[model samples]
Target: MFVKLHFEEWIKNEPGVSENTKELIDEAIICYRAQAYRAAYLFSFLSFQNLLKERMLVASCPPGYDEEYWKGIQSELRNDDKWEAKIIECVERERPAQIFNLSVDTKRQYLYWKDRRNDCAHAKSNKIGVSHVESFWLFFESNLSKFGVGGGKEALLEKLKVFLNPAFTPVDSDPTSIIKEIPLTVDSADYLEVIENVYELTTVDIFGPMKTRVWDEMFKLRGEFLDQLVEFIKTNQSLYTQLLKEDPSKVRFFANDPAFIRSLWYEMKMDFRTYKVIIGLLRHNLIPREELNEMISTVSSNNNDTFFFQVEEPDLLVLEESGFFSEFKTLAFVDMKINDFNWARENRNIIWHLIIRNGFDETIVEALNNTMSNSFIPWRLRDSILELFEEFPKLKEEYIDVNSRINGCLPDKLFNSN
Candidate 1:
């Protein structure tokens, strides 16, 4: 039996493929499994040509595609005898900056595959076999990315600015599809530019949906297109550090991903971003579970800087509004050592930071739940913690007694009786 072909990023599933093209791919897959190598090669070769024609049909650009040339190509594609030649014409006529650009050898391979397909179609004795079918699949899979527009990352981002902006973007444009195009457009060198532009758009008034929903696409990037991001991080390591520090929610997609974290674990410097990433992995109950405690301890020593942001009050407000400091406090409270809530007793300043910023969150409530002792409760949070008794049902204050006189929620009595 033929092993299932893996293209990693779903090259076979490119959008806008014609129904005939889709069926052709399916037929090719079936024939390959049946050991009918010639039949598979012919079907796949036809589908590849048809898929290219379809991508050209729908493919438009910023400065725009040539309607006259493309419409002629489209008209020719409707004819049985002329379409294959027209598809090749489109590939050749397209400039180095628009449509798919091919190298001298790659361009030669296109014709080479075409001739091989002719041998199968005309029943010429070229001896088509399993290797031929597999080689065609491999070639098609590797070159799938070259099918997009050609001006490189600059053109890609220019198009993206309009695509992401609700005002400039077409009403029919799908953000998800545009996201998939990011990898298709640029290589690893331009990945950070892509992220920074996307981040800028999130601040646009009409782009609110992009802000919340971008994490979904970012999740996709981290999964299928993670190599682009991994390379981006390798080159711009400090930017990620700053972004993770300035607004963890901004880089939450990367910070929260265990695979992304574990992949870059040793390569990364021990900074606050490292602290945040480790906390994110811990909070989500992700892998390398036993190593996380030691990981936290290692970075925590370097994380003792007084201010989370290295800026003045006014500039700090911007980062604060973006929910940056909250991640720090959240990380600050994550005690991997037996849920030591008493650590808060020593770090009283973080309690003030918590109250002034976002108030008590789940981590606070969770730590309080671990022990019946109110020793972790401080003077400032006394009234507020009591008020939150019923906020989260599962973590309701039923676990802690606020009114008890024995070791009560009073200011002076908030400490351990022992």
Candidate 2:
């Protein structure tokens, strides 16, 4: 009865129509604009059902509204291709109620809200907007209320709120999918585990306690792992080395390879995947910044394009200048450690200056304690440090004392503990 009255009021508002048929036309217009073709059809079909709900139809009027009247409204608008006739069929077939139905799975509702509904409402299409989305909810809510179903409005509302919020946006693709797609070789997991363990060991308790045995095992494992990886690459591509020179894109056989697992290990520390991918691409003479950007976007769709920081040429140049990239890439082959005070003295200026600059004073201090604590003097890079001391001895002394404090040279609260 309410729907009929509402329908009548809507039609009456249509221009150039008799007051009697005006309500019907207005209802059709609502259906047409909302793209509720199926609902329109059903509304026409169940015109009489409105009487039953209203507890009316005392012999003067038939028990229901005229199905014929609703049908004519639908036929008149059938020529519009934008309005699907089956909308009526769908509404009738589903026969969903207007009120909320908490018993129904919310995940289904959430999925529809997050994917289908959101897509329709926001996608590049003719029909889009908050009102359009709200119309569907209203249709369902009205029908559901008749069946005494209720409460999913909150779920629908939550999704609407998220869609409207500036902080959240849906991603068309996922980048971490690549991480999941990477396949592990038989020893790949073990190899990575060993490398991680060794890396951890290097960071903890100076290399003095178990240095000899640990170093031997680490080097041995590194050698074996490298050999196995190289062999795997060779087997996958006959022209392993040449792949680097010719076309790295063609060598994407490693997309699902064990190297990716190792790459993952490094990636967790500092997004080394792009660098590794870049290195692989350079080897193959195929660089696709666009593709790389897509990968980044897929994984992290913030839309700010901040991952641009990773692809920046200047940052890459700085890393190269600092030798950080070379050091990481060749970690397995090199024996790099602050061996003694003399070594620290030789490398102190540039090394410690970099350490402070990067805000890694604690790390450098820890390293110094383990390696250069015993010696009266330690490494300071060539003549540079000496010149610094001569140029400004007081400042140099302060610098040394501050650095020593960082390295835990004293037991006072003037450093990391403080």
Candidate 3:
């Protein structure tokens, strides 16, 4: 009955293990199942040694590889008769550099397995059994992911750039075919750099169209690695602004996870670019209603100004649904935007537009009543704006609850008779 073993099935499915390594391991597993205990031990020991050595030689030495010793290992691996000895020697030479990333415990197990292999190969009296083979198999499974090669970020990027470029890579190419090679080969820091590199392409010529494809594919990175991609988008000032510009389809993914939404919210920067992107992300009702309260909680904690002048009336209405917006907060933000000396008449128009759309309550009306005019816009235009608001019944009250200028600006109304 030709049934596959559990470990054999797992070996086939493990994406981190190289195909060459898996084939080598397959031989060992077959022999062990057949009760060829000595052969199994010999094959198991040699296969792992082969994996480590081959991974070392893949596509040039990555950074942190001991160049001198790497050259020595390269030379020794080429010689058929001495190669196996060189592997054992490499493991023996482990301590000073410990380049394979093996921990103290795994290294100890390797030495123990080597002795067991010697007994099988040298015709020693030591009896080989299922336990010996099983232990070796377990050790192999536990440690295989750690043995990945190409351990340098720069080297990884140098290679990734090649794969990401559409000219060199075929349209039909499964990026996963290349990405599969990336998992253990690259570090988390390398993952972040990869995302940043891809993003820079979007903002430039030649590769702009390809950026989304690359970005969408970047989501393929599993588990903790995916966080790096999100972090890059959330924390980067330019990218924070640019999300509004990214494919709208991505918002579902961006706002998908509660933690991700919270993270994106918390990372919001105090700038128009970040503010616009956050507004865009909040649109289309893509954010789950259940998560809105949490996001509102996030919004309340933010101490920065909302820059609401840029927002439309309907958008403010949308944010209000999530409990993420309040008249008081908008007024405060309105206060800040009104006060910034850099903004001119055009800015004031936008501010008045938002206030009219939301329709002022007593709090907003009173806030406006107490607000004063700034030097940025001429007091006449400010008075015109106030007059426009006052024509509506809600804002008909006389301005200025205080006689003195508020925050060093002139009275909320410079003209009284109108």
Candidate 4:
């Protein structure tokens, strides 16, 4: 069956989209129909790139940057070396923090999609699957509305409409519907029923035992369900508090599910309301600290490299206070790259404590040595290293002598002390 008619129309008529871009989308549809999934992805990616470039070029140029100057920059984007850099520059310039609600993790995901598009275009060994294409499409669709780029809200609503069952309206569209279905008084049975329904949606495999058209629809439904649940909790705060007091596990499902947790973190990374909910749960001992640690472990094991680091600053502090840092330190220092090492150095007290308490593990020592040897390493890290050396005097002389020879002098602290 065709993906969805309204979605196709939405993409076709998306403002600022060119006729040539429409042709690329049409080709993508044709390839998808033929089961040429890779080709379909490539064409869709091309359409997405063209539309993005056009939008960026129009919106991002500085007031003083005349049409001729804009044309010169646009021309440079056609070059292989210049394309990604130019796009990043445009995005940074136009969609600064106030305008774009994207988090560090989301921005990284965007760059990753761009890299995947390059793989598709340049015949890289990386396989382009249906899931990858779906991810790219979903990200673009959501952000289009998020950034308010040319009727994005209407476009998003139209797209969401395609996935929704005609008989059932989205919860956000009809507030009274949820109130009727979910019940006003919060009995245990009602709470359990609501939790069960939301859990099923969160855990459902989109590609298994379901038609392709239902996939996007289910995702939208789950999101709407979450919104309704959050609202219900807010409206009946006393009831939720009572229920949570009786059984915190009811709310723990959000933290327990890695996919759900990551999605929530990314979507509301900037919002305090969600953080309040999580912190409340933590304070009430609803979600065990060990559970949070396990969640981080699970995410790490699943190869989600950035989720933990992307946690908002306040939440990061909460996680640290809850003993998540012990678990974090195990992973952070192992093969620590410069960026991560620097991050650790910023939290030097925690890192130093973990190092000293754990005792001089060879891996950490090696990582420190590597950090010290890099001439470009930040002096803060070097100072931290020297402090670390002071704590473990046995390794101090050896490291000092070696580092001194490498850098031609001791770090200022040691050099001046003498």
Per-candidate local distance difference test: 0.56, 0.35, 0.59, 0.50
Clashing pairs in 4: none
Clashing pairs in 1: none
Cα lDDT of model 4 by residue, 1-418, tens digit? 5666444666764434579888988898788777777888888777766665655444333334566766787787778677756765654454322223345666677778778877887899999887787677777655543332223223323333432333454423432222222211122223434443333442433222222223222223323344455445434444344333333334553443454434432332322133344444544445445477654444333322122323455555565566655565566566363335445444454454455445544455555566555546656556655677777886565555555555544434433433
Clashes of each: 0, 38, 0, 0
All candidates in order of lDDT, best leading: 3, 1, 4, 2
Candidate 3: deviation at residue 92, Å?
3.7
lDDT by residue (96-206, candidate 3, tens digit) is: 454555567867888899899989998999999998988888887777665555444455566657755778866555555445545555655456666666665555542
For each candidate in turn, the TM-score is 0.55, 0.21, 0.43, 0.30
**Which rank order by TM-score, best down to worst?**
1, 3, 4, 2
Leading candidate by lDDT: 3
Off by over 4 Å in 3: 16-19, 59-69, 94-96, 150-181, 186-418
Estimate the overall C-alpha local distance difference test score of candidate 1.
0.56
For candidate 2, the lDDT comes to 0.35
lDDT of 2 by residue, 158-239 (tens): 3223432335634232212111111111123334443333334334332333322333232222233544444444443322
| Cα lDDT tens digits for candidate 1, 216-301 | 45546643456455445445555455445444443445545655666544445555345444334444344364654445344444
Instruction: State residue 297's C-alpha deviation in candidate 4, in Å.
Output: 76
The superposed Cα distance between candidate 4 and the true structure at residue 220, in angstroms, equals 29
